[model samples]
Target: MPHPTPSPREIFASGPLTGHVAVPGDKSISHRALMFSALAVGESRVEGLLEGEDVLATAAALRAMGAQIERGADGIWRINGVGVGGLLQPQGALEMGNSGTSTRLLMGLVASHAITAAFTGDASLTKRPMGRVIEPLSRMGAEFTAYPGGRLPLILRGINPAVPIDYTLPVASAQVKSAVLLAGLNTPGITRVIEPIATRDHSERMLRGFGATVTVEDDAAGKIIAITGEAELRPQRIVVPGDPSSAAFLVVAATIVPGSDIVVENVGLNPTRAGIFTALRMMGADITELNPREVGGEPVADLRVRHAHLRAIEVPAELAPSMIDEYPILFVAAAFAEGRTVARGAHELRVKESDRIAAMAAALGACGVRTEEYEDGLCVQGNGGGAIAGGGTVRTHLDHRIAMSMAIAALNARASITLDDASPIATSYPVFFQSLDLLRGETLVPAA
Candidate 1:
């Protein structure tokens, strides 16, 4: 059979988006919960875990390493761990699909053991540079061989008695930092990391919960994090929080259309991951935090987003590390705000699941938003929260953010906006359309 014409959904919407939405489980936490549970001595239960391909990849890899993990119909996972430093050689390469998180975290899990493993991934993941992770693991005496400049299809020859070291992060990446910390789990002595700029701390927080001696100290320069090697980790039940990245879509949706109010429930409020919310509020978005609570060692809350007039402001480089992944949707939010939104320190976007900086600039420009691309980031000029001129089809580049952002631009656009091949959204957020529909019903938005 011939393939259908590759196209994206044309989403037309105008809203006063008022209602509650439960976002999917936190991807970062879910990955960590599975990995940490695999290293525990006993069975651990996890609820509200993201069953996305990325987390599932971690679970599968752990099961390959002799852990018994299975999902129950009650929406919880039961894991029988192999205990710390108790891993076996897998029969073949552990293919990790498109998750950098899974690949890097798994690299850490494999680095200090007596086992050897190889990993491969999809085209996009294979193309992404793995040197950032390889350098630190190498410093700790793990041998890795990759294609040319350390991309995927990489082999890790583990260190039987790994040598731990004090590693300094050259850049602000939580994945790289977390990989090194996780590798330290089987090594002796102290493994320290100096991060000049802070990234998300989900790994650090969750590691401590698992009984690792993870410490954090703030100073004039930045944050210093240290973990004691060869520590025993005890697994516990995990309640994963709602992903803030997913909530960003509704934050944009309600902001654009006037007279809209939407409540996003159980959102993860980790300060490192809440940068977009800070930026939105600074841009005059109507927002309220309700019933703040804690879940699985992370702060959780409900976000009430109401449609309001927004004005843009200059976003600094220092803030980029915190909100890095949300830039595509943040660019969409900028499209409707008044004045110009400047984002810098965005060179990191070049190496995400896609080249998000270029992707957003191109896709937003297609939707009639005035966007100027920078070497690192972009500046978007808005029409004071007015409807965008939306007659263009956005190329999604197999990026979930690219697809979702274009869809958000369609919400208040004068014409329907089309995003080509939005299927990749399933990779991270499978219920994206469903949540949008639920919010749409409450907003009374008209769509075709």
Candidate 2:
């Protein structure tokens, strides 16, 4: 359950954080597993689904659209799918909560069905631009009526046997690509999407796992992805790997806090999403992979991270698409490094739950860390592992990553740090605070 009201938290500098832990399942895979399962004709069982607010919101929307989703006492999520082209019109507005992923991907599912649904979300999600997904879905013959600027609280009416268009990604966005792919599920012909820059391929991988004919070819422009529509899917038993994005917070906490040693087990190491680890190792963090293997068609590993004296390096702009969700915490890591760290080609941060580049710059400045903001990225002046001047409250702008990143910053700060609202953390990692407490080997007593 998420905190209904604002929940502020004050974090004091603590001793070495140490523990062996497992983060929640991959949020992206969890969302896809549920969705693809709901499109299969039979029962699909999912283990290790992230039971966060965002995912729960997806489940609720699916239920309204004729999917029978339930969580057993044993914690396995069982889904009975309505099959391709079988989704019913939702009875009421689909409340997306704060999940842009759910909002976008589900719109694709509805685009090829003869259904009408109204989409709505919380204040934070309502502000996010849906135009990226709407453009393609509209081209697939789905009609939309949205707020000004393509914001949420919108209406969409699907057309059966929708027209499939050959689309090219205007930007490197996995959500937009996935929305178009999902729309192709019930479409009549081969729907094509040419991506100039590759994003995460979870949707393509999961679609293949469910027996869809999704093909990819490399060309000069980038990868050309084509999906054959009106495909039948088979239900599957899926075990979601741990989220590398969630593991990032713990990885950085252990790397920057002196004397800290921790292990986060079962983290997904999909090449498309492992750029953060690459960037951290480039900056000289001691991270080792243990027992590398595959789970549910994705790479999995145990990550052992120890505190190391880090030196700053320029993060490659090419890695932006792979680890876009992790830049906030990466910024925190840069603050403790030996030299200036610069990140560019990540303008996507501006359209997230908040303007992450601007938010992180302002938040770090409040804690006495120097940072230069750019239109596309940020440059952080590192302190060479010295204690940071903290003792300030950070405004999270209802972004979970912002709140969690600031909490990690407090581990090496000279004084306590306060978060204006920690409640947003529940959207992705509901047990983030609990994991922090476990790694720090102490209970966190938030200030009143």
Candidate 3:
């Protein structure tokens, strides 16, 4: 069982951080590994899976649907799957706690199986718009009874012998794309998705690895992805790489804290997910990719980061999909840079665990950093490695990234920064503060 959420208030006005740390496994990959494994007929072995609450929610949901999942003392997870079209209707609502990815992707899995499953989540997850997935999956013959705006606490009734359609994405969303693909797994004929813009390709790659016939082609309009239905997936031995998203905080902390030298090992540098590193390098941070290799068909590398005088640069709109989850921390990095950093074409940030643009703007302003928020992005003026006034308490609003980002920003602050709730950090990075202590060379003392 996971520990109770602790209301830990971190106060770090620290010096140079010097250490090498390996972050937890990729959360996206961990969820997919468990999901795909549960759809295969035989036993699948997974190592390096993130044990955070979000992935655990996916695991619990799969178990409820009759997959046999177990973890060994050796840290490897084993799953005996129920095969495609073999999911049992869960007896109770699938509780998806703060994980939108699990809820959306699992909705796709349940959308074509001739079963009815109700999905519910924590307060934060229930508020996110599920209409993006609802519209497409509903088109595939699934019936949904959702909240007024297609929010969660919804029930999905799947149809057997579902209809397959070609969908051109209205927005660049990998979750919507993945849900549609997963729904196609049990339907007959080919299910096609025409993406107007590229999102993360983890699902496509992992689906192919599980012996599904998934194809990708570039046309005049964007990439076209097609998956054959009623296909059998083979169980695989998978090793999940370290998540770069989790590594973002450590990397940025090392860069901004001055005189810091650190190596983040075995991080997934998937081209689709390495946009943060590219943006940071463009901002003149001294981050080098060391020992590039491949793990479980994804690119993996060790990142060596050292403190450098950073200059803010305009982040390309095209880079948003690649590093969509990283903007909160990127904003923190920008605050310590030499000039104004502008990020645009990231409207997706508005719909995350919180309205990230608004959350970050308000938090930075509270900490005395100059920031301008936009409908799609932010413009932040750097403090040029100077002391940041940080006596204000930032409201995290149950957002894990916001809490962790503010904690990293506090390293360079003149005063101890406080967060309204750090408990949300357990959603993805449960060992985050422990790792922070390793780098900081002291245990983080929590406020009363």
Candidate 4:
């Protein structure tokens, strides 16, 4: 598929943002649902799957490996899985686009099967270090040939009856944890991962949902997750909740924009993924959960967020794993807060789609927000809920989160905020601008 062209857009200061809006389905869950469904024995149906390019890349890779996947007129995706240990070798290299999640997780799926495949991606993805995954996967008997520094454009040769080993994470990474668990699915005996710091547990939860035997035990180390390999997975009807990561932009925008009141519906409030909400509430954001319930084994809620006098607070380091992708937007919210918001223990931000720490510092500085950047985190001095001086252009560096976060900052700015290129937004939230327009009740014009 051809990518969207680079488009320069400007977001002007708007009146109170008010609307009941829903973001796309959880991108992480959407990717897992497709992969798990494709590994089951029968047909599985998924509703509310995120159709963004990142998730689509996962679907295409699964299809190439023999899963029959298609979308129905009702907007539900149907898949016929090839069963555990049944994936076929793709005829050519799998184009991963800009998704590190798809690239890494899919690498795990291919590691234990008896097949050889090549993986490649766009510029940003190719720059990320894959050695974190390679370390554990190699211990599991998979052979790899990667570029220097474990970059992409790598060839992986799978080993049937692969050796399953107990591995400990050197750092907290959901993608790495999920990758190890996925590789264990086709291996013999039990595959175990001992995480010293917990990450998202989507793989373990979804694994059990599909009838796989997954056990988790907490010890002095952290979360010990074990998956029994060669287990038969049953097809499931999955309903993906709204992405908390995507909902984050709306939540922060609502809190920082004066008089803004909105309800973001059906958002996933999984404890492991709700750190952004926790952090914002600590900053005195006026957010209330309505009709809280469970959807597809994850908690879901309608967030009624209204403008409040937000006060800056220290963001705890332990919350990093849960809201790793949300810090960029939180930084934006901090710029309009009452004092300095200190965020630390998030060194993982450096290895994301962009070096988020440095990127947010530079972007916020361009808009006249005082910030101190560190290797691990950033400290933003809030303006006591005042409008930001947003005359400068923000260099997005092709990160979707940076692009969207800066757009939200413009809502309370004295001048328009210019994005160097908003095309990268399509990788995750394709309709972000549309959602913004709906909330602001205005059509945003391009930056001249």
- The lDDT values for all models are 0.86, 0.95, 0.94, 0.94
Residues 1-448 of candidate 4: C-alpha lDDT, one tens digit per residue: 2345678898899899998999999999999999999999999999999999999999999999999999999999999999999999999999999999999999999999989999998888888899999999999999999999999989999899899999999999999999999999999999999999888888889999999999999999888999999999999999999999999999999998888999999999989999999999999999999999999999999999999998999999999999999999999999988989999999999999999999999999999999999889999999999899999899998899999999999999999999988989988999999999999999987776
Clash pairs detected, candidate 2: none
Off by over 4 Å in 2: 1-3
Off by over 4 Å in 3: 1-6
Clashing pairs in 3: none
Judging by TM-score, tell me the better candidate of 1 and 4. Answer: 4
lDDT string for model 2 (35-96, tens) is: 99999999999999999989999999999999999999999999999999999988889999
Model 3 residue 196 lDDT?
A: 88
Residue-wise lDDT of candidate 1 within 344-381, one digit each (tens)? 87899988888998888888888888888888999999
Model 4: CA > 4 A from native: 1-4
Error of 3 at 129 (Å): 0.4
Count the clashes in each prediction: 5, 0, 0, 0
Alpha-carbon error at 425 in model 1, in Å? 0.9
RMSD of each: 2.7, 1.2, 1.5, 1.0
In model 3, the worst 10-residue window by lDDT is: 1-10
* Model 2 lDDT, residue 54, Cα: 91
lDDT of 3 by residue, 275-348 (tens): 99999999998999999999999999999999988898999999999999999999999999989999999999
